[model samples]
Target chain A: MKLQINNINKSFAGSNNGQSAVEALKNVNLTVAEGEFVCLVGPSGCGKSTLLNIIAGLTAASSGQIDCSGRLGFMFQEPTLFPWLKVKDNIGFGLKILKRSKEKINEVVDYFLELTHLSNFKEAYPHELSGGMKQRVALARTLALKPDILLMDEPFAALDAQTREMLYKELQEIWQFSKKTVIFVTHNVREAVVLGDRVLVFTARPGQIKKEFKINLPRPRDINDIEVTKISNAINQELKTEVAEAVKELEHYEK
Target chain B: MKNKLIRLAKPLTFIACLILLWQILYWLKIWPKWLFPSPADVWLTLVKGFANHTFIWGILISLKRIFIGFGVSIIIGTLLGFLIAKIKLLRETVDPIILGLQTLPSICWLPLALLWFGLNEKAIIFVVLMGTVLSLTISVKGAVLNIPPILINAGKMLGADGLNLYRYILIPAILPSYLTGLKHGWSFAWRSLMSGEMLFISVGLGQLLMFGRELNDMAQVMAVMLVIIVIGVIFDQLIFGKIEKNLRAKWGL
Candidate 1:
């Protein structure tokens, strides 16, 4: 395993003085081989993004063990580009922070700008770009660092359907070329089916791995493909039960 | 260009109306010429002052004091603000005091300044510093605290740590708000300088106004007041305004 997570658990302190602690994650374990793509799918409040945050070291697990030995990149749901920097500069930000040579930074920035088809927008600020374009700049920023692993939390969820579909293809192409291990979190089952080599379905709040499924589909899987739809349907069926259980739990609390 | 002219017309019309009203009041003979000078009388006083170099000299001296005092305040205020913002203990203890000091009027410092520095340029400059430093510090602290956490996280993920984090992320993120602070600080400094100069100095615009008061020349006082207003409006609109507009355009705000 290139990455291993063992017996992970997380709890957040209740906001109010009298409330009980909120359990965010239950005992969980995961492993990924080098260059593998794993998708974590769950309903809302399932702690999928929280898990990704912990792995990226942006958030700490209350108790867990994670063993990995490589640079990591994280892509948030929002583009999170710096408004002050131009697209090329935003993409070059990580390199600048790493203190790369000016020539090297320029070279990498140019390459990714081309890869992301953002050459024309090199001097544009984040606020000038469309949602899709901003996300592309964000992805380029992460790719420029050339991390060994990428942790993406619903990076395309906010984009329009047409933009999302286009980026799905582009993301797959980039992943294949870079061959970085990926841990993706999303609520979209079809997105998981299309993107993941392995998919893990998570139970609702106080999330735990409910089931794991291996995708044996061929390369460049289409989200609308029959095989992908069938697998997505199965995952949705499992997810439906967990969602219903969560609703029942909520009702119990209300009473 | 046409739209710009249209926008300019509105304020110019309002100013013209104001002058016309002043002329009408003068024609009504509401008071003696020395007590209530007409717009023309004020304009004549301004022209005479310019020809004699009194107004020009006063403006130069006042500008010198303002620049020095404002510059020092920026340095001290920003450094202190950053220190307090970064240290939780300092923030909890010092922030409320700073807020309280900010509410005290700039002229309120005049008595203390006179006592401490005794009617010299030092006294006026000290007043200017007192007027602006707290506002600048408070603004810096607010800007620092208001920075979105995600930007910091993104910076860290990009390999920034410690000083690098602040340089790469925090500073740039807080810049827009900080610029606003600087603008506010300048206004406070200008007000403080005028009030301070009125009491302690003999060679600034504020002193010119005081001289007019002593001489019972309402026209000279009004002319000096007009000069002060013009300078304030010019700096606000031309310098700070231009910088803010450019930042907004670049940031697509």
Candidate 2:
């Protein structure tokens, strides 16, 4: 299946107190095929989350067309687990809502718990888990739906650095095994290069995709690899310039 | 064991000093033995009331009123809160009204309740309702609002919408706060019911207080006061405290 987002534009009405419509996304375009992992990197307030929200159908784009064939699963910045539910129940939440059979729901939940390595924590609540484990549970909850496309918006941004690195590696392993299409949004250049099959760099406010780099690095690529370093450095340089220009434009408008 | 004793040291010392002071005043002839009763005198009064079988009946009536009124508040409060949190227009209109109600003392509703329902169980139920409903509603609204926006998005992405969205996601996410609200509301309801009994003076711990007042019997007043304090503390420590502790431990929040 192919997911195509064409000429997507999103604007917030009266966001600047009637100065003008605040354009969050500007003519954004992207395409993903089955089993592809795409990472979107951008500066703060650069509409990376807006794009993800648009793709997930959480928010409507001012003008755009999104073509997708199957269900979309979302993983947010926070774990977003229901505090009142046990881990297994949270994972099987979507299935339960879809009215799947009790036995089938249990089976799928068990499979996802194993997939996310949260089988032992099946009865634990979200508050009982550490940050990384919570995110993993969130991942399991999404995977339980067997969504066609997984949209993640900085899902590990709140974890400690060591935990974040470990999760990134685990995510790569999960992706390799499942071969699911994923669109992950982040501002971390290294994270993008480490996990993405292709990295799309976004500019600051009124965000638009400035460049796309196909990561030719082999599987099990390390963040410290020479190729990874080259891409990260280049992206870092581009981001600095883009942010500087975006700030100048913003200041000019404010005056 | 040593650390546990240390934790009890402060309150234990305070109680010991209070008892010592009371004993001194009693021995010093502060008032006639019949008028200003010693601690032992009040203890005897408590046993006397118990032997007469009036205190237990008063306690039962008070408990019944509290349970009924508190039960109503929990139902109405939770539903009202859910509605206010989910519907923007309702929130805009009803939230301030709830806040206004919360500010007024539970006793302030007594006259109005009597006017509407007269001097009966309805008045007591109305008092309990006034005391607890706002407490539950506020907590529910606050809990619902505090739910991270991402959870809602995740729910919708997982095919939750309309009523299913609320039942599966919003309700569970807000439960801790809702439960916390109930704990708070129960205490308020219990207090209000006792106060209502005091005003009605029919059959309750509150009426026992009125009975002591009518006869100029300070020992009886002291006994009734002790019963009220003991029941309140025991109920909170036994029931609400246990529930709150279990929830926090199991949920790790």
Candidate 3:
């Protein structure tokens, strides 16, 4: 396995205000084989993002063990590119930090810019690009690092449907070529169905893996494909009950 | 294009009305003609002062002092800003002292500056520095703190740590706010330079104002005041406006 998690638990200590401690993740065990594409689908507050943050070492788990030896790259929901940097410079930002020679940084940035089809925008600033284009630049920046594992937290959630679908095709092509281990977290069931080799469904708050679905579909699968829609429906049905349970739990807390 | 015309015309019209009111007050003899000079008197004084080259020389001298004082303030203030922003000990201790000093008007630094430098150019520059540096540092601190946490997290994940984190992310992220701080520092520097020159018997624009008052030349006083206002406007529009426009383009504002 390229990544493994064992009995991970995370909770937030309530402040001086009267609220109690809130559990975010509980007994979350996960493993991913090298070059595998895994999707984590859950409700909004299901702690899927928390899990990714922990794996990225950005956040600490209260009590857990996570073992991922490979270097991890994270892509955020927003592009989050440095506004002052040109497209090429933003892509080369990480390489410069690694103290890579200028030529090497340019070469690596050039490759990713081409891979992400952002070569034409090498001189453009982040603000000059459209939302989708900015996100593409961000993708190139992440990929430029050549991380062994990529952990994405709803990276396309902010895009329009047309743009998001276009990005989905591009991402699948890139993943197929790179074969990097990917753990994608999203609330969209169809998006998960479209992206994942294996889709892991997470429960509501204090989230854990409730079920795992293995997709036996062929590559370049369309979101509108009958098989993709069929699987997405199944996952949607599973998620609906959990979402309702979450609502009921919220109502109970209010009472 | 029409919007730009309207913006310019409106302010010009308002100023014309104010000048008309001032002339009427003079004709009504609210005070002596010397005390309340006619609008024409001030205008002729402004023209004559420019012709005699006193106003021109005064502007050059004042701009020179501000260029040095404000330049040093920006350099030293930005460094202090980084120190206070990055270090917890300095942030907690120096921050409160800075706040206290900022409340003390820029003119209040005159007494200490005169004693320390003994009525020289250094004293005026010292007072000017005190006016803006504290505020600039505070602005920089806020700018550094206002950076989105996600940017920092992404930087670290991309192998940036310690000084690399600041060089690659923190500094670029703070540029817009830093520009705003520079603008604020500029206005403060002007105010301080005026007070310093007025009291210290210096040969700058503020000296023109003082000389006018000493000679009962109300028109020169008003002319110098008008020159100061004009210079402030020119700097704001020429320098700060250009920088802000570029920033807007960069930020997609």
Candidate 4:
């Protein structure tokens, strides 16, 4: 299955009492093929999450079309796991809603439980887990749906630096094994380069895809590797320029 | 050992002093036995009441009314609360009616209930149910309203929507609050049952108090009142208290 997003545009009309019209995205277009891992990287307020929401069909795009022929699963920044559900139950929640056979649901849930290395904590509640562990359960929950397309919005942003790196590596391994189409949103340039086959960078508010860089680096790329750092730096430079231009445009709009 | 005993010291001391004063007042004959029965007289009244099979029947009938009323209240309250939340028109239409019902005292319904049910067990149960259902519904509705939109979205993304949404997501999410509502509802139901017993003249703790009043047996009246207080405290401590403690501990509420 392929995801085709064309000429997507969206804006937020601020409400009364200190509300300003916030143009989040404008004329953004992207695509993801089956088994493709694409990362979106940009500075704050670049509508990275907004774009992901649009893809997941959680937010309606103002003007554009998204044609995807397969199911889509979303992993949010926060784990957003239901506090009332235990870890295994949370992962199996979608199946329970779908009224899937108990046996099949258990099979899929157990597989992911092992895959995410969270089998031991299956009975634990969301509150009992660390930030990283909770996010792992979140990912497992998404994966249990077996969506052809996965849209993740900074799913590991809240974790510590070490945990984030570890999750990134784990995410890459999962992608390699599952070969599912994934669109990951992040602010970390190095993370984008390390995880994504293609990195798309957007300008700040009223976001437009400013540049797309294809990283053909070998698998198991290291952060300290010379080529990886070089690519990261290049992307960072372009991102800085786009951010500066966006800020200038924002200042003009304010006046 | 000392610290543990210290924990019990205040209540023990207060009860001992109260009993001492009661004994002193009785020995001095401050009032007649019928009007101001001593603590020992009340104790004997309770013992004699227990010896009589009528007391047992009264207690059973009263508790039966409470359980019936409480069960109906919980069922209707939970169902209506979910309905009001899911349907806008129902919410608007029923909100004021529930508020009116909640504000009206349980005794105020006695005449109407008696007219409708004809001085039977149903009348007493109706009175108790009226007091409980309103608060339970409001509590459930409030809890439903407090569920964050993000959590609902999370549920939806997991293919949970429609009735499944409420069963899997809304119900569990609102459980703690619903339990709180049930606790409040139980207290209201207990009070309403007591009031109803007084009016309906059933064989219950309330009727026992009334019977003591008719016989001019103040000691028996005080004894029945003590029994009521003890039952209330015991239920609150054993059931609702445990439930609240467990829920708060789990959710860190």
Candidate 5:
């Protein structure tokens, strides 16, 4: 295993002076092999993103152990590009922080900008870019660091359908080339099936692994392919009950 | 170019009309020449002061006090603000006091400053410092607090920690807000410096205004007041305004 998580759990204390705690995750265990792509899919409030955060060491797990062999990278749903920095500088931010020499930083930045096809917009700021372009810049920024494990939280969720489809093809190509182990979180079942080597379906709040499906589909799977739809439907069937349960939980809390 | 010229015409016409009105009022002899001098009289006084070098020397003296006082306030205010912002306990205890001090007018400190420094350069600079420091400190604290947490997290994820975190992320993130604070602080410092000079000092524009009053020279008083306004507008447009415009463009604000 390139990464191993054992018995992870997380809970948040209620804001109103010692009310009941919100259990976000419970007794989750998983492993990812080198260069494997795993997608986590679940209903709203299902702790999918929370688990990704825990793995990135962004949010601490309330209890559990995680073992990973190399440096990590994270891509958020929003681009999170620095508004003040130009596209090239935003891509090179991590390398600059690591105190890389100017020449090395420039070399890496140029390579990634070329990879992301953002050479034309290298001088543009985040606000000037479209949503897809901004996300591409963010992707370039993360990939420039070349972390062994990449954790992404709904990285394409905010984009339009056409833009998202194009990025999916591009991302698939990039992942095929880089072969980094990836743990991706998303709510879209079709996205999970198209992207993941294995898909882990999570239950509603206090999320646990409800089921796991191995995607035996071949490389460069189209999101619209019949095989992808079949897998997505299977996952969505599991998710439908979880969504209903989450709604019931909300109403129960209200009462 | 034509649009720009047309934009400039409105204000110029309004000013010309006001000046003509003032000259007409003077011609009516509604009050003694010592009480309400015409615009030409004020202009003549200004020209005479320039010829004698009193006007230039007075401006230089006032500017020296402003620079020194403003410089010290910026340094101390930034340090104090960062300290209070980072340390929760310090912020909790000191923030209210800073808020209270910000509300207090700069002139309110004039008496205390005069008592402490004895009506000299020290007293005037002290007043200027007091005028601006609280506002700068409060603004800096607010800027630091308002920085989006995601930026900080992104910095940390990029492997920046401790001092590097502040240098790379926090400082740049807060720069736009800090510039706004500097502009406000400068205006406060300018006002405080003028008020402080009016009572104690004898070598500044403020003192020149007082001297004209003592001699009942309304033209000279109006001349000095005009000089003060011109200086304020020039610095605001040339210095703070330019910096703010560039920063906003760079930040895509």
Candidate 6:
């Protein structure tokens, strides 16, 4: 196994609304083989991201152990590029932190930039780039780390539909280049179906793995493909009940 | 290019008109000659002072002390800020005191400074140091507190920890705000230095102002005041303004 997450649990203590504690995740267990692409799909606030954060060690799990085999790279929902840095600098940021040779850093950065097709805009600042381009640069930055496992959280969700569609193709090709293990968290069923080797459907509050689907789809799957759509519909059916459960709880809390 | 020229000409014309109005007021003999010197009299006073190099020496001394005091303030402020920001106990105990002291006028440091360092350059620089350090420290603390947690997380995930994290992320992230604090601290340092110079037997433009007042030479006093204004404008527009504009444009801050 490349990564093994066993019985992870998390609870946020003492909300500002005077609630005693809010359980975010409960007894989540999963394991992934090398080069597997797993998609985590759930309702909003369904602890998909909390699980990713726990796995990446960005957040502390209230209870449970995560045994991971290798280095992990994370991409946030936002590009989160350092505004002052140019595209090249942002891409090379992790390499520089590792104190690699200057030439090695430049070579790795340049390769990633080309991999992400951002070679022309290497001199541009983050603000100067479009949303899609910024996310591409963010992807390049993550890839430059040469991570053994990639943890992405709705990275392309902020982009427009057309850009997101193009990115799906690009991301599939990019994933094929390395075939590294990936844990992608997203709400879009089509997105999960298009990218995931196995799609894990999570339940509402105090989330647990409710269901899993193993995708036997061919390489370079399109969102518009009938097979992808059929799988997405099945996943959507599983998600609706969890989403309704989440909404009902939200309504209760608001009252 | 034309628009830039026009923008520049507008301020120049407004200043010319103001100077002309002052000349008219002097011609009207609204106040006694000793009390209200004409622009020509003030200009001649400025010319003579510069010719003899007295005003030039005063300017140099004042600037030298400021560079020393303000430079030291940046070091102390940034260190203390990091210390306070990292330690919760210090944040609770010392943070409030710094905020309260920042509100207190810088000139208030003069008497205590005098008592501590006696009548000397050290005392004056101490006042300047006191004037600036508190606010600069506050600015740093604010920057630290306001850092988007995502950036820190990104840094750690990227294998930047300990001093490497600060060198790569935290320092650069806080730079724009730190520059802003430095600019504010500079102004306070000037105020504290002036008040200190005036009270002590100091060789500075503030001393020149006091000398002019003692001699009852309104022209010399006006000349010294003009010098202070010119210096203030030079630092504001040419130095701080230029860097701030570039930083904003480059960083999109």
Restricted to chain B, the TM-score per model reads 0.93, 0.89, 0.93, 0.91, 0.94, 0.96
TM-score of chain A of each: 0.97, 0.95, 0.97, 0.93, 0.98, 0.98
Question: Which docking band does candidate 6 fall into?
Answer: medium
Score candidate 6 by TM-score against the native: 0.97
Colliding pairs, model 2 = none
How is the predicted docking of candidate 3 categorized under the CAPRI scheme? medium
* lDDT for position B112 in model 5: 92
Model 4 clash pairs? B58-B203
Worst 10 residues of 5 chain B by lDDT: B150-159
Please write out the lDDT profile of model 1 over residues A170-249, one tens digit for every residue. 99899888898999999899999899999999998999999999999987888879999999999999899988878887
| iRMS (Å) per candidate | 0.8, 1.4, 1.0, 1.3, 1.1, 0.8
What TM-score fits each model? 0.95, 0.91, 0.88, 0.87, 0.96, 0.97
**For model 2, how does the per-residue alpha-carbon lDDT over B103-159 read when each residue is reduced to its tens digit?**
999988999999999888898899989999998999998999888887788788888
Candidate 5 residue lDDT tens string, B1-253: 9998999899999999999999999999999988999898899999999999999999999999999999999999998999899999998899889998888888888899878988688888999999999999988998999988877887777777899888888898999999989999999999998988887765998899999989989999999999999999888877998998899988879
Q: Candidate 1: deviation at residue A204, Å? A: 2.0
TM-score of 4: 0.87
DockQ of every predicted complex: 0.84, 0.65, 0.71, 0.56, 0.69, 0.78
- Candidate 6 residue lDDT tens string, B147-237: 8999888888888899988888888888888888888888888888888788889899999999999999999999999999999888877
- Quantify all predictions' global Cα lDDT against the true fold: 0.92, 0.88, 0.92, 0.87, 0.91, 0.92
Model 1 agreement with the true structure over B19-122: per-residue lDDT tens digits: 99989999999889889998988999999999999999999999999999999999999998888889999998998899998899988988887888887888
- List model 3 lDDT by residue over B1-253, tens digit each: 9998988998899999999999889989989987889989999999999999999999999999999999999999999998998899998899999989999999998888889889788989998999989989999999998999999998998898888888888998898889888998999999999988888887999999999999999999999999999999888878997898899788776
Error of 6 at B98 (Å): 0.9
Number of the top TM-score candidate: 6
Q: Evaluate residue B15 in candidate 2 and report its C-alpha lDDT on the 0 to 100 scale.
A: 94
What is the RMSD of candidate 3? Answer: 3.3
Pairs that collide in candidate 1 are none
Q: Which pairs of residues collide in candidate 5?
A: none
Per-residue lDDT of model 4, residues B85-146, tens digit only: 87899888988788887788877888999999997888889899888888999998888988
